[model samples]
Target chain A: AQSVSQHNHHVILSEAASLELGCNYSYGGTVNLFWYVQYPGQHLQLLLKYFSGDPLVKGIKGFEAEFIKSKFSFNLRKPSVQWSDTAEYFCAVNAYDYKLSFGAGTTVTVRA
Target chain B: DVKVTQSSRYLVKRTGEKVFLECVQDMDHENMFWYRQDPGLGLRLIYFSYDVKMKEKGDIPEGYSVSREKKERFSLILESASTNQTSMYLCASSSRTGPNSPLHFGNGTRLTVT
Candidate 1:
């Protein structure tokens, strides 16, 4: 089974700081990459996804991810983050099948 | 927007008791999934159903089973609950758009087995 790896376990930053979370996957075959976010007391929601065409995908809340096939990475980044963007971020990848493998999530704590 | 609802927010059960986690999706999605989420372990798929009465075991299907008798509802059953099985159970659904389609998740059910 394929696995995903998120290097950062926890991140803490002040408001207006730029945020970047690293994500890497194991499988080399055709894959779909995604980033999902879960706010406190809320369910997981899609942040962004990458299937084909463009390697740079823009998602909600001014979040974006770049899928670099050679590096086997799809990293999530934001120019400036708000306290509201504080949430648990997950990086997921699925191979030809419908089963998605998720990384150990990263908890982003933004201070006011 | 897609809405998925889990029947229970929290549950506690004994070791030898049978446990059921129910999930219902309002969207007419063809696929439904059951997953367990733990800190640092991420989300692990337990089971998924493609259509009515069709089920498939996922990466961690041990000690767990699922049923999909209807299109909207999917049920996960544990024959004898164990302490290790205690975790946040998540239910998600997606249309048959493709494998790339994002899954719509429901508020999870936190289960504890004593």
Candidate 2:
């Protein structure tokens, strides 16, 4: 079974602070990875996804994630965050079979 | 733009009542999924369909049944709603025939079983 792990449960940061959310999955074979975000009252939207090639992938809203195969990690990062970036982020992985497994999610609170 | 819509944004049902959650996608996607979102559990897949009339069980399929009679619509059913089953139900669709496609999601239906 494939499972995703997100280490950060909650994070609070001031505006313009750098942000990094850790994500790791337990799949040995080739798989697709995705980062999804949900604002307070909105639905989950795809921020970015990794299909094949290119370890580093850029996503919407100034977010990016790097897929490191060796460590089974695909960590999301942003140089600076805004108060509007406050949302719950989820890390998900899909195997060749198309079933997606998601992490527990990290709630980020950006202070002005 | 792809659009997936759930029938209801909020629903309240009593215990032992039958509940139906409808999901529709406009993109003619081949794959549709049903998931439940809980605070600490992330997103748990309840069921999925690869093609019309073909359904598969996901990680958490217990207490849930699905119907996909048409390509554009998928329905999730709770034979008998329970308080523990109260959670945010999410509907998603993907174009993948196998498994490696990005999914588009609906706004979700928040179900409360009292």
Candidate 3:
């Protein structure tokens, strides 16, 4: 079974601080990676996704993720985070299937 | 933009009662999914439908069933609601064209079983 692992369960930092969230998946075949964010009382939205080509994938709100296939990792990063970036982030992996397996999630609390 | 709509934002049901959660997508997406979200558990897939009247078991489909009679609508059914089933239910839809087509999520339905 394919499983995604998020290294941090919770993250806390101040506004403008650099942020990085580690994600690792157990799939050994062709895989797609994604990061989804859920704000308070809001629906889950796509943060970014990595399909093929460039390992560095960038998405809305200045969020970027690097797909390191050899490491089986797709780590999300931001040069600076704002208070609005505070939310629950989920790492998902789809491997040779239409369905995706998500990690346990990481709650990021950004202090204003 | 694709829009996924979940019928209810909140629902409360008693144990042993039948529960129905409806979801609809405006786009003609070929894939629809049902997921349950809990604190720290992220989202666990319960069921998914690729086409009309076609359903597939997800990672955790033990006590749930799904119906996709139409391309735009997908319903999740609980034969007998259990307390453990109390969680936020999220519906999502994605196109079948590319792997990069991200899933558009609904606002989610918070279901509480007593």
Candidate 4:
């Protein structure tokens, strides 16, 4: 069974602070990775996705993720986060299937 | 824009009652999914349909069933709702045209069983 692990349960930061949320997945085969964000009272939206080619993928809202196959990690990062970036972040992995396995999620609180 | 609309934003039902949650996608997507979102548990897949009249059980399908009578609609059914089944349900859809298509989600339906 494939599972995703998000290391950060909760993170609090001031505005303009650099952010990084760790994500790791357990899959041996070819995998597709995605980062999804859900704002307060809003539906989950795709932040970024990595299927093939570039390991470093840039997403919306100045967010990016690096997929390291050796580490089995795809960590989400932002150089400077804004107050509006406060949301729950989830990492999902699809290993040759229609179903995606999602991490527990990280709650981010950016203070102004 | 791709739109996935869930029938209800909120629902309340009694234990032993059957619950139906409807979802419709406008993109004519070939894949539809039902997931439950909880605080600690991010999103657990309950059921998915790859085509009309074709359904597959997901990780947590013990208490859930799905129906896909049409290409744009997927329905999740709970035979007997329980208090523990109270949670936010999200419906999503994606194109099977590509192997890595991202899922478009609905606003979600928060169901409470008492």
Best by DockQ: 1
Candidates' DockQ values? 0.85, 0.78, 0.79, 0.78
TM-score of chain B of 2: 0.97
What is the C-alpha lDDT profile of model 3 across B1-114, one tens digit per residue? 889999999999999999999999999999999999998888999999989999999988988999999999999999999999999999999999876678999999999999
Error of 4 at A31 (Å): 0.4
* lDDT by residue (tens digit), candidate 4, A24-90: 9998999999999999999999999999999999999999999999999999999999999999999
- Shift in Å, residue A80, candidate 3: 1.0
* 1 or 2, greater by lDDT: 1
Q: Determine which window of 10 residues in candidate 4 chain B has minimal summed lDDT.
A: B94-103
Ten contiguous residues minimizing lDDT sum, candidate 1 chain A = A93-102
Docking quality band of candidate 4, CAPRI definitions: medium
* Candidate 4: residue A57 lDDT (0-100): 100
Global lDDT of each candidate: 0.96, 0.95, 0.94, 0.96
Per-residue lDDT of model 2, residues B15-90, tens digit only = 9999999999999999999999999889999999999999999998999999999999999999999999999999
Instruction: Point out the higher-scoring one by TM-score: 3 or 4.
Output: 4
Docking class of 2: medium
**Model 2 stretches with alpha carbons more than 4 Å out:** none
Q: Which run of 10 residues does model 3 chain B get worst, by summed lDDT?
A: B94-103
